[model samples]
Target: MQAKEIPVSKSDLLRADLQESLSHSHIDPAQITTFQRIILTTDGTLTEILEAYLYEKIQLVKLSQEIVASAQEIKALDLNIGTNIMNRKVLLQGKISRRNWIYAESVIVPARLDEIYRERLLKSQEPIGRLWLEHRVETFKEIIDSKRELAGELSDYFLIKSEDKLLSRTYRVFSKGQPIMMITEKFPESYFIDK
Candidate 1:
């Protein structure tokens, strides 16, 4: 007689999918280093985390900021297609070491944000996490994706080879029960290896 097939739960499938995704990116979740795991899973502000880890102040260096009409691909932000969104890119670097620790890109729905928060986001060099803290914005972060990938163009920022692997996580920030922004943060896999 053929063996009966046991049903797989939804959560189990999801867990398997996440593991497969990580494996596809050449990362084994079970074997990931502590620092790498922390960077991948933390919902807290990375600016503060990096500062504490490196024992140096971190700076946010703006790479570019532009207002562009978003496409349908950004359903994660829950914004209508063609809506004007702020596309901001920046690097989180060690102030003393002058080392780029992380690269982040944010797609913000300006209309959903308060004037003060929006203004600071546009004009201040502070990290988004810092701005969230300074403005006292209550936010919920939901990590949507995490993976490892070739650095490609981002290699220039970390001064690493293009083929080097980068560990990254993408998350959506929700405020007032609405998705306000979607951010993707990446760092060189070699940066946070020490115990």
Candidate 2:
């Protein structure tokens, strides 16, 4: 599917004062209420929350690993999980920069033994392909909004946080991080590229 750019001004997106209101933890109740209404109207479920968070967390793990190799510090990352049960689209890009690379080495925490066991069971019962992530935020405000969207994506992810802030993610951050990365475009099937 083709993608469309979000129609928001750079300055509006980079607004400094509202940083606290961007994430699930900080947004005003009214703002959250709007999202709540949307979810309720669409009959969203608890499982959707878990699905989005799991996807986002897996993405950050890879990012943290990539950032570890660099000096930039990734203060925050937002990974777009996917369409919800209702198919509302959202976009997020986990991002890092040379200036912040030293601070951006935060990644998702490791899973518990029970989780590992569950994955083992699930893998045996059903084949699952590996997920991928890309980073795209350019400023702190986007970072904050992304986090909230991430929380909205999956409430459970709210429990996941920056642990051992210096740890590396599974994927490589590479030499220069892209500001507009398409982090997780899961292509399970091999498709033809014009180029």
Candidate 3:
């Protein structure tokens, strides 16, 4: 006749059976018994087998949850980098273009001058374009390098620098003379100005 396999269950009955097996065994009292191999023994406690099975299941559940959370975070990051960033990139690329007018605005200038400035600027085309491009590019590079150095120093936190209007907080573009374009942040995009 074949012997029945052990049923895993936690109860007083299982504990008592384990105690009985230990007492009847010929192993010396001084010997240390490893619990792992004990479960496979013919007289192993039902509670031991049950606890091991439950522990394995709990661990698998925890691992699966972590994977799902990570996948969601990656999807969010993809949208931020792809669509949102592309729009910003296109606008910044015109910085070096001489034909492009740097919209002039400041605390001192009236709102009406905006259209007049553009008209005058269109007529001028690139009177001071070279001078504007040179200074702006140098300033741009300085800001980027400074931020990079700061990043190296901090390493723990993000360090980003960009230009923006102090009061209105709008993106202001300028030229060599009357005004200059001040951006809200550091950019890989640049245009032809002076230096």
Candidate 4:
């Protein structure tokens, strides 16, 4: 007799998608490197993780920040199209080694943020996770996607060839049961392999 098929849950499907995305970079999910695995799965503050792993403080270098209207594609932030949002980009680097570790882009709904949080986010170079901690904001991060792609313009920041692969993840942060920010973080696939 044929066995009955079990229904796949949404979380199960997401796991499958993540595995497929990792495989595109030639990574076997079962045999993924430590940092690569962390990058794929961790829903916590990456800046702290980098510091703990590298044994060096991390620096937040703000690249650019601007107020812009949200696009229809920005469904992750749960903002209406044409709503004002803070579009920001930055790099997380090793403070002592001066090595760029990760590049991140964030779309934040300013209206959803408290005045102090908005001010600090726009004016300070603090990592988002750190800001959340300082203000004692309760947050939940849900990873929405993961993939591998060519570095392209990001190659300049990582000092790698444009053809090099980058492992990336996109997630949305929610506070008070509302989506507050959507962020994407990317790092070269070749990094954090040896140690």
The candidate maximizing lDDT is 1
Please identify which of the two predictions, 1 or 2, would achieve the higher TM-score against the true structure: 1
* Candidate 3 lDDT tens digits, 31-145: 3223322321222222233235333211000001000112121221222222211011111112223121112111112221345553443343332223234233222100100
Error of 1 at 179 (Å): 0.4
What's model 1's lDDT at 187? Answer: 94
Query: Would you list the C-alpha lDDT of every candidate in the order shown?
Result: 0.86, 0.24, 0.24, 0.85
Over 88-139, each residue of candidate 1 has an lDDT whose tens digit, in order, gives 9999988888999999999999999999999998899899998899999999
lDDT of 1: 0.86
For candidate 3, what is the total of clashing residue pairs? Answer: 20
Clashes of each: 0, 23, 20, 0
lDDT (0-100) at residue 150 of candidate 1? 93
What tens-digit string does per-residue lDDT give for candidate 4 at 1-195? 999999965346336556555555565655557677887777778988989888999999999999988767667776778999989999999999999999999989999999998999988989998999899989988877777789999999999999999988888899999999999999998998955
Query: Residue 143 in candidate 2 has what lDDT?
Result: 26
Q: Of the candidates numbered 3 and 4, which has the greater lDDT value?
A: 4
User: Residue 75, candidate 2: how far off, in angstroms?
Assistant: 5.5
Per-residue CA lDDT of candidate 2, range 1-195, in tens? 889887864335423433332333343324333333222122122124323533332112222222112133333322333211111111122233111111122232112113553344223321111211111212211122222222222222222322311111112112124221211211101111112
Off by over 4 Å in 1: 1-26
